[model samples]
Structures are given as C-alpha cells and as structure tokens.
Target: MSGIELKQLSEKVFYLPGTVNAAIVLNEEREAILLDTGSDKDHGRRLKKACDNLGVKPVVIVNTHSHADHYGGNDYLTRNFDLPVYAPPLEAGIIQNPVLEPIYLFSGAKPLPELMSKWLLAKPSRVDHILEPGALELFGVALEIIDSSGHAHRHYSVKIADVLVAADAVFGINILQKYPLPFGQDIGGQIASAERMADVGAQVILPGHGEASEDIAGLVKANIAVFEKAAKTIVGACTGVAATTVLKRSCEILGITIKDLPRYYLNHCTVMAYLSYLRESGHVELALQDNELRWSAAGN
Candidate 1:
C-alpha cells in the first residue's frame, strides 16, 4: 500500500496506516466503521478518500480514546457524513470539551498558548455513543471492547473477529524506541494493560501509532519494559526532588531533551504519573516541606 492507502487486516477489516493507524471495518452492505480519525481535518479528509477508494461508505466512528491525535479528525468526518461517534465514558467528556485536555495537563489551570495547540486540543466533535467494555454489535459486526485505560483515562481497544485494534494499550516497537518514556496518566495501569494484551488472543494486533503485528507477546513485553524502565528512572531520581526536577533529571538520564513547552508539559505529566505510581507501589514517598512538594525514595 502507498501513503495512507488501505491494508487488509482480515476478511472484513482493513486499515489505513500513517502516523496514526485508522482501522476500517466493513459490514456486508459495505458500510464502514472507522476506528479512529487522525490528527486533524486533513487526516480526516484523507481517511475519507481512502475509504472511498475502497468502495466503502463510512457510517460510524469509534474513538479509542480522548487524546487529540486519536480523535482529531472526528470533526471533519462527522461534519461531512453526520456519523455517530463512539468513545469511552471519561474520554467522551474530553473529546467533546477538548479544552479539558489542556486544562488537566496544566494542573487544572488555564493553559498557556503553546499548550492550546491542535496537538493538545482538537476541534469539538459529538459522541453519539458511550461504549462499555465487553461484547458489542455494530452494524452486524460483533466486537469486544477491551478496557485499556491508563494511557488515557477510560481508554478502550476494539476486537473484531481475530483482529484486535489494540489502540495504545501496547505501542509498536518503533514507537517504543522513539519515545523512551512513553506517555501515560497511570504507569501501573499502563503496565497492566500491556500485560493484558499478551492474552487477548488476537491473530493480528493494531496499535494506534505503530505497525500492526501478529506477535502479541513480543509487543506486550516491549511496551511493559518501557514503562518499567521509566518507573525505575523516576524512582531513582526521587531523592528529595521536586516533581519538576525529577522530570528534568529523569529525562537527562534517559537522553531526552524537553525542547519546547508542549514537550515539557507532556513529559512533566508523564513524570508525575510515574511518581504517583511509584509512591503507591511503596517505592517512593511524597512530602510537603518549606511550602514545596517533594519526593524521595521510600523510607528516606
């Protein structure tokens, strides 16, 4: 397949691969269900074209999570087709009110200009359905919604036939290598989700941001390793260090550079996630002293 072209995943399922992979599932009537729209309207346009080229009419959209990139193309697709959108509960709130993304990222304050970019805030789109985990039937296709939260609150992955649209529960190996400290709101949950994928029993697994693979165990292990390594780095840095300093030191040790406000805030959020997870796991502790919140190794 060429750029943004469709690749077959199964008899009824196909995918358009780009920076973010969008899955296309077809019903007997040739109506399509889009698993995710890409980063913006252009991606939406391209996805629509790709489906058109396949001779399928997109009838529904399911956002695997609330992250902008996962649902950014929602507005364009919905506007053009008036399709019903489905997403998990908590994620649905953010997808409709995208400002919540930047708000929460800035610690519930008004976000700065840089934080308000499309990378963090996509245009608002309507969600017609709130998907719950377990068996679901969409346009005659049977699917199982698996709970894959942690990367984003209440995130989900879809399983159609023997193909599992794993979403971000487990990223592709290339993505894992590119981003040493993968983004997660709950490191422990992220690790658990990756582990869960090992037994999901899918013949083919499609990660939201990487190549699809048949090696479920290998993908699971690679993803879990990244989270565990990040946790270890954060715990090692937590020697009476403030959250910001911990993020800096951990990134430094990981050979990552926070080049801009967006990346800084993103890495900062992930670092805080690791700290929260480590503290709960009893590897680290949080304290308030001199009007500053700091962290250190447990029992320090």
Candidate 2:
C-alpha cells in the first residue's frame, strides 16, 4: 500500500491504485461508498486511512465481483467498520464462503493447498445485500448496476457520476497483452458485456485492473478484439482435438506458459469458455470417440 495515493476523479468519486483499483464515492450525507476493496487486509487498512484523511466514513461496500483481488479486503473492512457489504447474485455466495472460489475453479473437487492462496481465496465476509441489475440508490448516491457477467459468474459494473466501474467486464490493454486469453467463464457473455460497456454512455471508464480512461469506445473495442482473437485461435485449433489438446495448443499459439496450478487452471477455464462460445455460436461441435470427448469445427 506504499506510495499509493487517493486520486479524485470527480468531486464525489476518489480512487486508490494498487494491484487493483478501488473507488470511493462520497454520498450526499458525507459518507463514503467503496466500490471494491483491494487484495487483502492491508488494503482495507489503507482504504480506511485514505477515507479518514479525506474526512469521510465508509458506510457501504459494493463489490463488483467475487474475485479475491476485488473483494479480499472485505473481511477487514466489515470487521472494522459498521458497513454493509453488497455483492452480485452468484458472486455473493462465493464472497461469503471464499473457499468456494478454489473449489469451483478446480471443478468442484477438493482444490490443492497451493491453489488456495490469498490470490484465489480470501477470508469470508458476510454479504449484507444481494444486488441485481438495475438502478440503486445507496446513501443518497444513484447508481445504475449493469450486468457484466462472464469474467466471473454474475459479475457487474457500477455507473455513477459519469464513471463506469467496469469490474472485470474488460481488462486494461496491458493486462490483455500479458494474458492474451483473459480468464472468463462464458466467452459469449463476456463479449456481450464488453459491447454493453460501449453503450454505457459514461464519460470515464474505470476497469478493475487498470487506470481509468475517457476513451470508452477504444477500451471496449480493445476488449472485444482480445475475446475475438482468442475465440479464433481456439476454433482453429479444434480439428477433432480433445479439449485439453485445444487448451495446450491455444496456449502455445498465444505464447502463454502454464507453470503452476493457478495459471494452469485459469487458462484451462479460459479455453473452456472459448469452446463453449464456439459451440453456442455454431462454429464448433463436440463429439466422443475412443472414450474421449473431442471438439471439431461444426459440419466437419
């Protein structure tokens, strides 16, 4: 949390940049509404300090999703302040039972101890509110909750004061360059969400992992391009190939090396997302042969 500064985007909105970008929106009553907490307890403390320095109190925390990097500080924040935590539908369950993140990532099997790091699992915190996609008024601030699912199940973006807190609906351009195939559970939904972001009509777009930008159109296009390219690579690799084979070959095409369980599973899930997207779009189909399931281009 060293060297981090609270930057004010608007009179009502402030942000702290760290591993993840968290925003603070001041309501009419002078209380603060935290957009998302950062990656751990220390982040929560730092956020608290920032609020104190700004002369505001945080009365509520609205998590954009259940990913540990976005909500890991919830435990500390909730325990320290009398704040209500709000999370999206399916994500709320995972936030309150952090172990579920690793469990589901491991396909519902017991995850390896190494897979349960703080990056993937955070301490559990109670969810005081379950948010749905719609208009919400909290602490005198009006917010439009947009459905931005796919990066994570039931993920959401928040719109207020001309800034869109776009959770994981899209990644920063640098993050896209680093992980060519971004983690997504449903590629179709992810693409749709990116398109939705383009139509958000906000003056500024703040992604979960990147600096805020006013070029919402450019950002949306970049995000869609990444998804489209990954889909193409996966589809091209699917010439009667097993899912695992497609995953491996796609990683090779993207120059991504999976050296650890976390990286391996994340990329594996991403490839699965592409496969699902291809199948749903009628570009690919699945078949079983020799006791193994394989994917092939549709009508092949």
Q: How many backbone clashes does every candidate have?
A: 0, 0
Q: Which 10 residues in a row give candidate 1 its minimum summed lDDT?
A: 1-10
The best candidate by TM-score is: 1
Model 1 per-residue lDDT tens digits across residues 118-175: 9999999999999999999999889899998899878899999789999888899999
Q: After superposition, how far is residue 133 of candidate 2 from its true place, in Å?
A: 1.4
- The models' CA-based lDDT, in order, is 0.91, 0.89
Model 2 misplaced regions, further than 4 Å:
1-4
Output the number of the lDDT-best candidate: 1
Note the residue pairs that clash in candidate 1. none
What C-alpha lDDT, on a 0 to 100 scale, does residue 167 get in candidate 2? Answer: 77
**TM-score, cand. 1:** 0.98
